[model samples]
Target: MIRFGQLVRVQDGGEYGYAVIGDNQGDYFTENFGAKPAWSPTSKGTVLNPNEVHHRKTVVEDQTITLFIDGQQILSNTMDGLAKGIGAFGFFKDRGMGSVLVDNVKVTKITPERPVDPDNEGVVPVEIKSSDMTVRLDEAFPRVLDYTLTNGKKMQGQPTKIDTIKINNVDIVPEVSLEKVSENSIKYILKAINTENKINADLTILLEVKNNTLEFSVTEIKNNNTSQKTNEEIIRTLEIPNHSLVSVNSSETNANVYGAKISTDTTVNGDTLTEVTDTLRSFNSNYMYAVISNSKLSASMHSNSQYSSGGGANDFVRINPRVKEFESYNSVGLSSSPWIYHRDVMFNEQTLELPEAKVVITEDANDDGVVNWQDGAIAFRDIMYSPVGAESVKDLVAYRIAMNFGSHAQNPFLMTLDGIKKINLHTDTISFTKRLW
Candidate 1:
C-alpha cells in the first residue's frame, strides 16, 4: 500500500511503500522500497497460500498502521513522518510466483473525535481526602499540590513543580488530566510529546489513600511511537520538594542529616556533641524503602524489591533517592530508571505496568514509643520480611549450606547426616558404626 501521490516502484525504489510477501514463509515490511526498510515476521507461515481466497484489511490512523488477516491482527506498526495525504492501495505479484487473483476491494475513511476537555480546565485544584491524610492534586501539570497528615504536618513545601518525564534525554512536559475514582483515590493521565523525534508517551498514575498510607503507582507507560528502528530511553521521576525533614534513614544508607542541622548539643561520653549536617547525598541502588524523619513523625516510602534488580550492568531498574536543598529547604524523593530495557539493537515495542509503591506516615513506625531513625529501619525490615514468615538462624544456616552444596545435593539435613557417617568419603578408616547413632 502507498499513500496518494507516492510513487510505486520495484525493489526499494519508491518514496513510500508497505507490502506483505510470502516468499520466506510470511513477513511484512513498512517503507519497503525506501532507504530504511522496517520488516517483521508474522510467525504464521504461508500467509498467502496458492488456490485460496483471503480477506486482508489495513487500517491507518495518524501514525499507526495495522494490518488484519481474516479478522486477526497480524501486525501493527507506528512510524514517524508518514504522509497524511489521501491513501492509495494496490496489489502486485512476482513474475515467477504464478498468477494471482484480487477482488472485493473496499476502502473506508474514519475521522477520530478530539479528546474531551477537562472539567476545570486546570484552573482549579482537585483534592482527595481520607481520615488520616489529605492530598491535593494540581491538574494543570499533574503533580501533588499538597500532602498533609492528619496531625497538621505538611509533607511538601510551597510552589510545587511538575514531575519530570524524560525521553531520549529530552524533558517532556505532558498535558495532564485528573479523574476522581472515589473519595480516597484519583488517577492522573499524562500525555507527553517529543516533537523532535515525533514520539508520543501515554502515562498513567494512580494514587490511593489507605488509612495513614498513600499508595502511588506508575501503572502504565506506553510508547505510542512503535518505530523499531529508532533508539529511545524513557525515565519517569517523582520528586517531593521542600521537605523540611533533615534526618534520613534506610537499610541501604547510613543515618545522616540531609539538610542543615539545628544546634542541639548532646553529652556523649561526658563530651558535648554538636549536631552536624553534610552535603547532598544520593543513593543509587535497589532500595526497598527509605524513611525521612524529624523529632515527632516519620515518613517511609516503600518499593517492590523484585522489580528493582537490573539483572546486568548494561540494563538497570533502580530506586534512586536523593537529598538536596530545594528553595533553601531539605528535599527527598524517589526516581526510577527506564523500566523497560530495550538493549537489543532491534527492539520491539513494549508497554510496562509497574508495581505500586506505598508511603506511610506515622509517629512511631516500630511502636517503640519514639520517633527516630531506628524506627525507620525497623519499618523497612518489617515491610521487607512480613510477606514471608520469620526464618530461624538455624534455618538460614541450613539454607546457606544447601546453596553451597549445589543443586544435586539440596537437602542440607540429609547431607549433614551423610557427612557425619562418612557415607560418600573416600577414607574407609573414618567410618561410623551403626551403634554410634
Candidate 2:
C-alpha cells in the first residue's frame, strides 16, 4: 500500500490533495478550500501487488496533479479554484494490522522562474514589415502593439498592457529582445529570472512575414529547473484583440462565431429581412483552428500538435480556445478578442518545442470576394480536412460506428444507413459501395 499527497494547505480542516494506491486500485482525491472531498479513480483491481515494492511519484503543478507508479502514469486530475498558499507534503497508510516500510524518499520543487524586476524598463519597440502587412511588438511586454494591413486597416487595437504569460499563477514580465533572423523573419526572445529560486526561463516567439500573412509560432520554451524526470504542467495564453468576431471551427457542425449574431425576419409584405447584430458573446471549446476577423482583414490560428516520449501524439497538448469581449472604441463597433489557450504537462528539460501554429491572414479567406463566416468555414476546411490517406478515413468511420453502436440502448445504425443511401442516390456515376471498395 502506498499513499502520498502534496499542497497540503491545512491539516486541521482537511484542505488538501492526495493520491493513493492500495488493494489493486488507484485514485487521486482532493478537498480544496475545505470543500467536500472529490476524487478521480482509475481502473479498479489494476494497481498494486500484495507483496511487492514499487516506485511511486506524484507531481503537483499549478492546478493539475498527476500520479505515477513504476514509471507508468496512473492518474491525473485538474482541480480548479484550488486553495492559495504554500502547503506541506504527507504520506499515509490505512489503519490496518500490517507493517509498511518506506525508503529512498526524494522531493524537488519544479516550478518555473519569476520575473527579475516587475518594473524594469528598456524595452524598445520593433516592427517587421512584409510586402502587404506590418506588425509591431509591444515595447513593454511580449504582446502585439499593432497589426496593420496594406490597406492601412489596423486589426489589433487597444492591446493588452500587461504581460499575459503566467507561471504558477504569477505573471512573468520577462526581459524582451528581438533578433532579426532574416529580412522577413524575426525572433522575439523573452527571458525571466528568479533570484530567490535560482531558476531561469526562456521563451522564443518566431514571426515570419509572407506576402499577406504574418505567421507567429512559439518555437521554444526552456527552463533550467526541470529535468527529463520531472513532470510539470505549463499553461500559456495567446490573445488577438479587438476583432469583429472570433470563430472556432472544430467540425463541420460545431462552428460558431462569437460577438456576432445573424437573424432573419419576414415582414407583412412577404419580404425577408436579414440583420447582423454584433454583441459580446463568450465562448470556450476545443478547436481545430480559431479565426479572428474584422470587416477588412482576418487571421486564423492553427492547432499546434505535440508528441510525447512514448511515441504517441498527445492530443491534450492544447486544451481550449476562449473568446471574450474586449473594450473597444472602433468605428465598426467590433470589440471582441480571441484567446488561444494551452495547458499541458512537460516531462522533460530539452527545450520543449511545439508544432508551428500558422497564422494565415487574408481579406477574403474563401476567395469568394467576400468576408464573413463562410470565409471562416473555408479556413477551417483548409486546416481540419486537408488531404489524408485512406487509413484516416477508415479510422474515422470506425470511430463513428463505435460511437453509434457501443453500449447504447439507442442505436443509430439504420439512420446512418439511410443517410448513406441518400448520398448514393445523389451520385449516379460513382456508388457509395464502389467508393468504399
- Badly placed stretches (over 4 Å) of model 2 are 1-125, 168-170, 195-199, 226-228, 232-286, 305-355, 367-369, 380-437
RMSDs, each prediction? Answer: 20.3, 16.1
lDDT of each: 0.50, 0.48
| Residue 225 in model 2: lDDT | 59
Provide the TM-score for each candidate, comma-separated.
Answer: 0.47, 0.45
Clashing pairs in 1: none
Candidate 2 TM-score, true structure as reference? 0.45
Write model 2 residue lDDT over 1-437, tens digit each, in one string: 44433444344545666665544345435434444355564433235557778787877766667777788876677766444335677765543554556789887877443323222255456777888888776554545556677788665422235554444344555787778787767887878665443436677878776775556666776765554232232333333232222232221122333221111233223211112222313233333334555455555545444311111121222323343333321112122122323434443334433534444456676577756545644554444424456444543322223133355625356666665666656655243231210
Give the per-residue lDDT of model 1 (tens digit) for 1-437: 11111122233234344545544546554444343344444434235666776777777765466767778776776644344335455655543544555677777777554333223333466777899888776666445555788888765412334445555446667777878899998898888787676658787888777776667777776767656454543333322222121223222223332211122245322211112123332222234344556566555555542333322321222344454433333344544323433334353445323545565656676676777655655554433424443443323322112243435545556666676456425554442322111
Question: Total backbone clashes of model 2?
Answer: 0
lDDT score, candidate 1, position 246: 21
Among the numbered candidates, top lDDT falls to: 1
